[model samples]
Structure formats: structure tokens, C-alpha cells
Target: MRHNKWWLLVLALVLGLVLTACSGASDSTEDDNAGENESAEEKVLRISSPSDIPTMDPILAEDNVSIQYTDTVYEGLYRLAPEGEIVSGIAKKDETEVSEDGLTYTFHLREDAKWENGDPVTAQDFVYGWQRAINPDNKSFYANYLMSGKIKNAAEIYAGDLEPSELGVSAPDDYTFVVELEKPVPYFESYAAFPTFLPMNKEFIEEQGDDFALKPENMLSNGPFKMTEWNAEAGWKLEKNETYWDAENVALDGINVKVIKEPDTALSNYEVGELDRVTLYGSQVNDNQTSPEYNSLAETSVFWMKFNQESKTASKYMQNENFRKALAKAFNKQAYIDVVYGNDSTPVNYFVPKGFVKHPETEEDFQQGSDVLAYDVEAAQELWATAKQELGFEEVTLTFLSGDSDVAKSISEFMKGELESNLEGLTIEPNNVPWSQQLEIMRNKEYELAVSGWGPDYKDAISFVDLWVTGGENNDIAYSNKEYDALVNAAKGELATKPVERFEAMQEAEKIALEDAAIAPIMQRKTSVLAKDYVKGMDSLNPFGNDYSFKYVDIVK
Candidate 1:
């Protein structure tokens, strides 16, 4: 009896042990599958910007930051898709009609489209916005720019030769908007997607007057995101607009941006999982090239040193063509890029960036077979000698203007060193200022030499070549060439319908500008960025327009 009792106890203990082991295995399996059964978390993306957006008004917004922010908060007739395709915004794409000559476009706006204030978006808003842009009294910088040569009577309106009411855009009814073009523009859809072409409510704008777009409450959004918070010193926050027409398809809940000027600080935040995206430069790029998060993206932006040929500037030497050529060739572009950017950015001698646009018929890259302004040290010295003799001065000093950002400072310092070393008795004073101040100085032509850059507003060589045209709005350098202007104008006017000839004309225009040394070409920018692995659906880095479209971006784990 005692032996049987002991055997029973032993059997009980073994069963207990087996049950404990089985329970442990079950808990492990549940732990492994826990995430699958849990509810999804809210999708919010965090990003960093180097500086605050310059302005909120699309008509006056010239910088990329302002354009990017404005594009998200406002809707044009057309919008660029995530993959850079022209997509419908307020206007229904399939219902739109075009004249056989491609000179007129009639758009039917969607009835359901409403502004953030719950007012129905109408075709008259577009007419009013376009007319305001062309109104000479408004002094919009981009008025006669992209619109003048294309939109019928736009140039005349901007020049005060005609009334703004006669500017070619009309609203027949509440929903029908008609535009008359001066000529056939192949890239008209691309232009329509730009921020400058966005609609504005005349009543709302007039009510706000000078206070318009200065604060978040003063604005209304008609796009996928709405600005919920804006603090220039801190940054801005954008939340998904529940009132947006296509809000159901918009994936991101919100995007939080911070203005972090220091790359080190930005990277540290990224490492701690505080930031999902950040741009890196110089040594930061070199250190993280092997990381999975690293990405080197080629962009359409090209930076150059713009010489102020105005006689009032301190550097009187810039008026001489040989002096400009000498300054253009004095530096080693490759070395400067390597020392400052430390990425895949290539040294370029031409203003138009490579791989940006292609020939219409041959489909060859636009920069192909184009003349290269070769860097010849010997030639540069000879040009400097001639310039000095012509100016009757053995020594010259110039102020070099640039932004105060770390990357900008590095670039300016390198150029200053190179110029001082290469050219005898040449002194380059590096003057680093805030971005806004730099822009103001450039606009007033208040600097001797300034580092400036241009990114495409549309995917065409004309975007780059048109800047140096005689009396062009963007021609802040005071550089003008009649031949260059003729070529560029032909590309925009008479050759508008001829794709190949237009392309060639722009190419020839760029060559003329470079030969005259209107601006010293530097390296085309290739941005180095780091993004978290869980961040998804941001597939396209646009060569034109806004860099990112957050509508399709999703966070998945």
C-alpha cells in the first residue's frame, strides 16, 4: 500500500511538470503573433527642414520650401501624382476639353470640391487668381514669367499695355473655366500643376488684405493636408484634411516638421527614432554611406556663382567679361564638391543640369554633345591678367555672398580659399548671411558675388535658360544678352509647337550664356538623405515641382 501511494505521488509530479512546459510554449507562440492581432497604430511621419518656408502666398513664393508647403495646402486644376504623373485635382481630367489647335483649354471643376471653410470651389476663383497674378499693380514676380509667353495677352497685361480683365482666362459658368493660350505649349499640364497657378477666393483674400496668408487662421486649404500649426521659429505641422475630396485615399494622419539647421542634431534625432527623414552633407554623408538608411538622390538643382555686373556694386571688376570668365574658371569644381558635399554630385560647367530633360525626337539627354566650359588654369590666369590691365588695377577685392548654413559656409570658404590662391592679388571676402537676407540681397542686386541656385519649375531646358534673358524677372545678376534672349524667346514663342527646335534653341541659349560667363557653373546637387525602414510609399523624388507628395505615404511595421 505504501509503495502504490509513492508511485501515485511521482506520477502527479510528472504531469505537473509537463503542463508547465506546454503552457510556456503556448505563451511564446502568442507573443510571436501578438502584433498581427493588435489594432494598427496611427501613421504619423516626422521630418526636418533646414529653414522656415519663406512665404505662404503661392504667387510670391519663389523658394522650394514655400512652394513645397503651398502645394500641400492648396489645389490647382491639376496635381502631380506620387510618381510625377499629371493627375486631376479640382478639375476632372476626363471631362476637360482641349481645342484642336491646342491653344485653348476648358476645364470642368468637380462640384464636390470644397475649401477648408466649406465653400464650394468654383471656376471663377481660378479666373480671379490668374487675373490677380497678371495685374501689374500686384507686382507678382512669376506673373510675366511662366505665364507671359504662353497665356494669351498675359505679357501685355503684366506690361501695363492691356487691362488685367482682358488676360485670356474666363469663367463661363460656376464650373466651367476656359484658358486661351498664345501658342501651343506642350508642357501646359505641367505648368497648371505649379503652385503659382493655384486658385484663390477673391472675397477671402480681399477681406484679409495685407494680412492674407501671414498666419494659419488667415488661410484656407483645398488639398489633402491643412496647416494646423505654424511657428516660424519652431516649424510647422500639417494634418490630413478630413474635408478633402479624396480624404479616404489619403494614408498619412499627419506630418510633423522641425527646422533643424545642424546636420549633427538632425542625425542624432534620426538615430533616436525622433525623425524619420533628414538630409546629410559633407562628412556626415561619408560616414554613413554603408548604412541601409543612406540614400544619395540626384536632383534637378544647379548652383552657380552669380556675378553682379551692376556698376554700383563694390566689385567694379565684375563689369569686365574677362574678369567674369577668370572667376568662373579659377576654382576646382570637383575638389570643392568633394570637400563640401562628399557625395555623388558631379562638377558641371553648364547651367542646365544633365539628365533633367531629353530631346523630343532623339530622346537623347539635353546636355549630350553640348559644349563644356572646360576649366583651364592657364587660360584663367591669362584672362585675369587681361582683366586687371583693362580695369587699370593690380589688386581687386570682392565680397562673396552665401547662406549661413553649414553646407553653404563650407562651399563659400572653399571658393574663397581657391580664388585667393589661384588669382594673384585677388581677395574674396566670405560673407555668410541668413537665407532670407541672402535672397533679399540677391533680389536687390546688393552683393558683389553671390552663390545662387535654380531648380526646375517644369521639366524643360527652357526653365534653366530663361533666367539669363535680357530683363528677365529672375535676372538679378544684371547679366543680359540680346542673342541669348532671342533664342530663349523663340523656344517659348515661335518654336512652341516644334518640340525639337525648341529643345535646340534652349541648348544654344545656355551655350551663349556660359560663353559670356554670365554665371559661373558649379556642381549639380545630389542630396544625401536617411530614412527609417518602416517609412514606406514615398517612391518618387520629383525632378520638378514639390519634392514629396505625402498623400500616399504610409507607415508600416
Candidate 2:
């Protein structure tokens, strides 16, 4: 069997080489005729964004679009390579010094790393960025992330007990940045690579004032690419930053991303060569499966249904444990994915997606033997009966908030059908709104139920599990459990030094949340893309943070 699989791989590689050669040969005539134009052969990657970028400020970025764009234009101490590997950004490679006790990390910034305006990328940029992100006045959505990393005084500063200047980050010199952690974090480097930790030029930021990062001209770039043009109604464009320290190795000359919401429109543009890559869903996937351009990836992002415990219209129903459990069990996730996605995405029963992390000691997958999200229509009906009796109600109606995108609408419609069909006397009215509006509604706890998802900011399970903690920044559901909080706190506290114990605590915490139906696990997403044959060097998909790094991407001629 092993020999056969190896032979298959060899055959695939040979076929790939043949296809590449054929593509290059077919484009030779056009390339020769366009020699005088010059721009025809420029290496540009054209892609599509499902929504508009919410913000360019790294500190305020919470949605995927904002975070991905911020990642491209900003650099921190480190950056993530393809497949989530840590790589140098402004920090010099192999030059970071660590204390023997693991409480401090000192990074030496590369002098050559400079912003687009020719300002040197210094350690103080990082110091200012970290301090600004956690400052109370900023109201950064990711402020809690710093506390989770155990950065010294982060909790105190966030709690108003200490000042942001005392947040344990300092620049002893122009090129040396020091960080003090309250406890050792094994994933500190990974956190540094996150968008929220990206550096900001204090001078440029202050000069821009209220307009900072709100437009293309207001931003500075030390990363491989710098934004040249941006329009909220249109799209954004990024060009290679010549001032980047490693600009010589950067492949693409520019990247153009269009704000396209519908897959059919994106597919039409891709077919006409206006776009290089487009994602497919539902019947589109099956139609393109035989095409050479077809590609798919099982992502780390997980989608779920969140019930607002403080909802004005449905608080009584949402507060009932039986009601929430009944709704969670009433839907058939596998059937919905099959009908709506028509891809390789799998239904999930846990918050932490499978294949993301494993048991530190046994090396076993973390999702083993969990069925809290099981679908059982009969059991769901029974629970609904009990809930109705407890609440003294016969019929209930709730608003289901969702994004206005075609895909989001499909998911909402299917879920509404499933829940209404299984649970008697229940009506789900889906209120589809724009992506930004949906986020605002959920954040303000104005929705009875919402369809939401999360991709890890780092590699740890804590990234997903910590969202349900009481008063957590992302805890829009208003679900709280003291025991669950203790488990999560322990995992981040006393268990910080014990790998196995920490993993166990996180696992227990997830189980408790699922059992309580704090959120209904829907599916582990699989991104399926169709790319032109000439595109190369993007095979390895990032399981976290931004999905793609165009730094190494190229147009193979």
C-alpha cells in the first residue's frame, strides 16, 4: 500500500510538471507581443475578499478581513511563514536572548528593516504598539490577548490599577526590545507573530491623529507590501515595499483584492482572467472538481451558533438550559454541510477544531471521544417539551442574526429550516445584515442567535476556549460559569508550567461549555479555491492568522 501511494505521488508530480510546461508554452506568443507594454508581464496576484476590510489599525482589528490586511502592511518582532512556522520580521534571526528563568525575552531589531517613509524600524515601535493596544482609552478588542500571554502588569493596566507605561515592554535602546512576562509562555513567539502585536510608528500614528489607519495614505508599512490605494466601496491595492529589508526576495510586484461577496460573480471574473484565485461553494465545488485549477484546504476555523443570554426578546428562553440544549441538538450539521457547502468540511462537536492541537504527552488528537454536539431529533423534541413546561410557554420566536453574504444566508436558511422542523412551535426569523453591522449587533448583544466563527490567533487551544469566559471580549453570548472560569484560569495560571495539566484543564473547560450548550458547534470549514495554473508557491495553507502570505507567492512564467 505504501509503495502504491508513493507511486501515485510521483505520477502527480510528473503530471504537474507537464501541465506547467504546457501553460508556459501557450503563453509564449502573448509574452513576446507584450514585451513593449512591460506591465503585461508584471507579477501581480489578483484575489477576492468576501467583505471589506473593517480597519487597518492592528490594535482595533477583530474580523478576519481587517486582520489579514493588517498582517500584510505591518511587521512585528516575528512573522508567520507558510503553514504557521515562525520567521524573522524586524527581529534579527537567531539573535533573541532569553533569561534562564523564561520570564524575559530580548529581541534585537534589524537596522535595515524600515518603514515605507524611510523611518528605521526600531524596538520602540514595538514598545509603543504593545502599550497602545492594551491602553484603556484604545478599547482594543484584543486587549485580553496580552493578559492571556501573562505579560507583566497587562491585567493590572487593563483593570485600571496600573498605567499603560508600566505594561512590561520597554526599549532599552534603539534596536533592543525587552518583554517581561508574569509567567513563561511556550507560545510567546507565536503570539508575537499575531497582527495585534504588530508594531506601529508612534510618530506617524500621532501625526495622523483621528485619521490614523482609516485610509491607505494614513498607514505605514515595514512589511513586504505597502498599501497604495484603498476605497471601501471598491477594493484595495498593495505594492511591494522597496524599503523592506528583505525586498530582494519578495516575489510579487503587487496584490489586488476585490470586494466580492458572491461566488458566482467572483467565478465570472476569474474565468475572464481578471482575478487569479476564487473560492467555490455548494454546487460550484462539484462543478469545478475535475478542473486542474481546483484546490481545497481543511481549515482550522470553526463555525457555531451563539445564543445571547441577555437577549431582550428571548432572554427567558435562552436562559433555560433545556431550551439551549434542545436547539443545539435539533440541527443536523452533517446534512446541512452536505447541502450548503458540498465540500470536504466536517461537522464538529467541539469548540477546538480537530487536527489543531494534541495531547502534549500522548501525542493524541484533542478532539477524541466528544459528542456534546450530537444531533438527536427525538431527544431534542423531548428536551423542548421539558423546556416549554418549565417556561410555561407554547410558542416562541427568536431573531437569528447573520451576515448578508450569499454563503451566510445559505447557512442561516438551512439552520432555520432544521431547527423549525425539529423543535415544535419554534420560529426562527433570520435578520441578514452587512458583515460590519452583524459584528456590531453581536458585540452589543442585540441578537437572539447569531452565526459566527473563529480562526486561531495562535496555535494554542486557549485561543478558542478562552472566548467563553465571563466578560471575555469575544463573549457576546453572555454565558458564564464559575467552574468553567476556574478551569480556564487554572490552565493559564498554575498549569502554565505543566504542559499535560494545562491541556487537560482546557479540555475539561471545553467539555463543560459544550455540555451547557454555551454555543452550538456546527462545522469545521474547508476552503476550496480555484487558481490559475501559472500561480505557484502557495501550496502550504496557514492554519491560523491570515490564510495566505503573498510575500513568497509568484507568477510562474
Candidate 3:
């Protein structure tokens, strides 16, 4: 009996041990499965922009497409949020400082921020970037605008007078950087958020040389994502940078960006679930305006007629103030907006787009077409007669250069008909070229009159007013006014510390620009994006163009 009892006790003890081990194993297996599921659920997002990316190199990139591409691969000291507010990026909140004169800026980099290649991101990286941009060999169109005469010898260097090393940027240590400006720019902080102002790895860039930005492996990034694939004209892909300082905040595993110029094709792809988002144009909006899947966003962009005041061949007539004014008065803005925008656009008569800036003194708003330059046939005829009489020409033939897109063609035809019908002696010609060529022609000042648009660089009145500031590279019109120049300069200098005073001065400058007929403001742009219902957190304010923040976006199931 004692032996049987002992066996039973032993059996019971062994059974209890087995049960305990099984329970522990089961819990371990469950935890492992949960982790695997979370990893499997990680998503890869796909996005699209209308234009092809020009280049990945920040120094060489100047156009909108290039700017968008750079946004994915690089980050500045600060970043502009969807709300147009400045947010810290590479630097911690405690590291930035503004000078008393507001002419100098200092930045201290966080210790954790590092390049993809395991190199620490230092202040010297920024100094190198600034020097490279202003370097005469680079010949970057955006360098002058960003430097804004700030880098000590940047202007002279651009003019071939000094070496790039003489520029104002300096780095005393790996973490400390200083930037000196030519004048006190109120929006300097916002400008710092631009991709052109981002830092680059000097060692890597120098090693790669001309072939640096050609491939994904050839470049190093400090942003949330790194370039994983680049196929030139086809498309590109971005994978989350595990080494990114704020990688925890970046939720998406990867992103694919496609360049689809044809709006219809893009829409088709979106409908088929291949594309996550697309931008709609003109009549297309009419079809989608009532749909639950469609969303229309109004961006701060002014589409206007750019006149070539510097063109020796075309400027003969375009240089005349009366000729330009006559053209502005002749065009029926209402009809143009109706035809171009259908029901989703607004007509603009002022250079400053609506919802862009408000009057600081009276709390009044400055908007497009708010102060009208009436569309009067009699007024247009009088101006045309004066221009014809002054120039002593019997017939004036002008070619308006435009993009080859369908919308662009329609706009050109509208202008040609308006000018020919309104003025007897005027013969308007249409020269439709590819969008890329159109930019070249405009930059070289080779067109008589052209259709163009100006998207804001920063959220300030100066962004618009500075375009015509005497020697501004963006001043394709060559419209020079000492009064306009003075107002712009005064605003930059006197109102650097006073936001309200600066706003008033800029408003006065914009008013003067419109009254002088610098450029004929056509209509404010309302961009339409058709996004999938699952895609969320893709939105932008007036100034910052369409930018995707993977950290905030999620794909709902």
C-alpha cells in the first residue's frame, strides 16, 4: 500500500510540472505571433505627382518637380508642416537662436541625427551645402534666391568675383553653424525650411562627384525616408530610413512616387486601385465634384501672363506699359476662369492671390480680383491706340508661348481671340511648346508674352513682391519700378522686427505692383486631388505645395 501511495504522489508531481511548462510555452508562442502580425501589417504607400522629377541633387534642382523629389530625400534645420508652421527637424528645439539684428542665424544640431552611411550629421554639412550652392561651377538658379545676398560673397561669387569658400556660412565645430544675411528678412526662418537649404554629406558628395545623385546608393539622406529606387523618367521609390532620428514617428514602410502627366491616365489608375492619389484638372473636376471620393483643395498659386520685357525681339512691343495694360484690360477674366476652372475656380485681378495675405493695419484682406482692373472694351481700345501711336507701328504681331497641355492650348486660344477681336491693329499668335521648353524660353527671356504661374516660396507678402524687385531672376517681365524696389527694400530693412509694419509695407508694394501692371493676374489656382478613402493625412496649406508626411499618414483597413 505504501509503494502504491508513493507512485501516485510522484505521478501527480510530474503532471503538475508538465502543465506548468505547457502554459509558459503557449504564452511565448502567442507573443511571437503578435509581433509577427504587427510586422506583416506594415504598409507601403504609393503617391503620384503631375510632373517628372528633374534631378535629385538639391544644388542642381530648381523646378517644382525637383523640389518635390528632394523633399523625400533631404531635411533642413526645420520643416514646414501641413499647416504651414515651422517645426524642428535635424535640430532639437533648444538649439536654434536668432540674432538681435535679425540678420544672422545660429543652429545647433542634435547628437543623434546622422547620415544613412553611419556618419554623424554636423554643422559642416550645412556649410558645405551653402558653399556648393553658391559655387560658380554649380550655377544653381535657386542659390541666389535662398542665399539672398546672405552668404558673405555669394552674390560676388555668382557674378564670378570670388571663391565659394568666401561665402558667409561658417562652422566652428561639428554641431555649431552660423549664417549671416545681407539684410534682415522677416521670413528667413520659413526659408530655412526649403529643401535647397538642407544639409548634405560633404564626404559622400565629393566622393561620388558628378555621378552622386544618379542612383539610390550614391546618395545619403537624413530624412524619414531614403531613396531606394530611381528610374529616371518612369518613377521612384522611397523606403523608411531605419537610421532616421525620428524613425519611430514614421509609420509607413515605404512610398512609391509615379510621374503621370496625363490627368485622365492618372485618374484611371486611381480608380483601378493602382494609384493612391491624383490631381484633377478642368472638366475632370466636374465629373468628380459630387463624388464622395473626391476632395478639392485651393492652393495659393497665381496663374498670370508673364511678359518678356528683356527680349530684344519680343520686347519691342511688350516693353511698352500701354501694350501690356491693353492686353490685361482686353482679356475677359470671368470667361477665362469659367472656361479653365469650370465651376471649381476663382478669377484673380490682383497679383497677390486671395487667402494669401491680409492687411496688418486695418485688418483688411488682400485677395485676387478684390480690387478690380475692369474688363472694359473702351478702356482696352484707348490703351491699344496709345501704344500703337507711341510705337509708330501699323500692326503689332505678338506670339504668346504656352505649354502643350490641353488646358494650356485652350488658354492660348482664348487670349488670341480676345486680343484680335478687341484691338483692330493687333495680331496675336499662339506658340504652344512643351512645358519644359516653355520654362527654358521664359528663363532666357525669348518670348513676347507667356502664360506662367508663381507658387509661393514662403508665407509672406514679400514672396510675391520680391519677384519684380528690379534684378530678381524671377522677374522675367523685366518690369522695373524704383518705387516698387524702394518699398520692398524698406519692408526688408525697417520692418524686420515689426510684423505689423512689415505687412503694411508689403501690401503697399503689392498694390503698387498691380496698379503698374507688372503682370496680368489671371486666376487663383484650386488644385484637385482624388485620393483613396483609405489614405488619410494628405493635406497642405496655401504656401507649401503637395507634400506627403508618411509619419502622419495611415492606410485604414
Give the Cα error of residue 88 in candidate 1, in Å: 1.1
Q: Which order, best to worst by TM-score?
A: 2, 1, 3
Clashing residue pairs found in predicted model 2: none
Candidate with better lDDT, 2 vs 3: 2
Candidate 1: stretches off by over 4 Å: 1-40, 369-372
Q: Candidate 2 on 458-483: residue-level lDDT in tens?
A: 77777777778898767789999999
List TM-score per model, in order. Answer: 0.90, 0.92, 0.87
Compute the lDDT of residue 85 as modeled in candidate 3: 66
Candidate 3 clashing pairs, residues 3+ apart or interchain? 152-168, 349-369
Highest-lDDT candidate: 2
Ordered by lDDT, highest first, the candidates read 2, 1, 3
In model 3, the runs with Cα more than 4 Å from the true position are 1-42, 360-362, 367-372, 545-551
lDDT of 1 by residue, 1-557 (tens): 00000000000010010000000000000112223443467676777766666678877666666666777899999887765677898999888899999999999999999888898889999999899988888877666677887899998999899999998999999999999998888778777887778899898999999998888888889889998888874677788888889999888877777766666777777776667777776788899999998888766666677899873755568778999999899889888778876788888888777887888899888886433455677788999999989889888889888777666788788988988888998998988876666666776788898776666676667777777778777777888788988998898788988988999998888888888999898866677777778888653356666666677788886
Question: How many residue pairs collide in each prediction?
Answer: 0, 0, 2
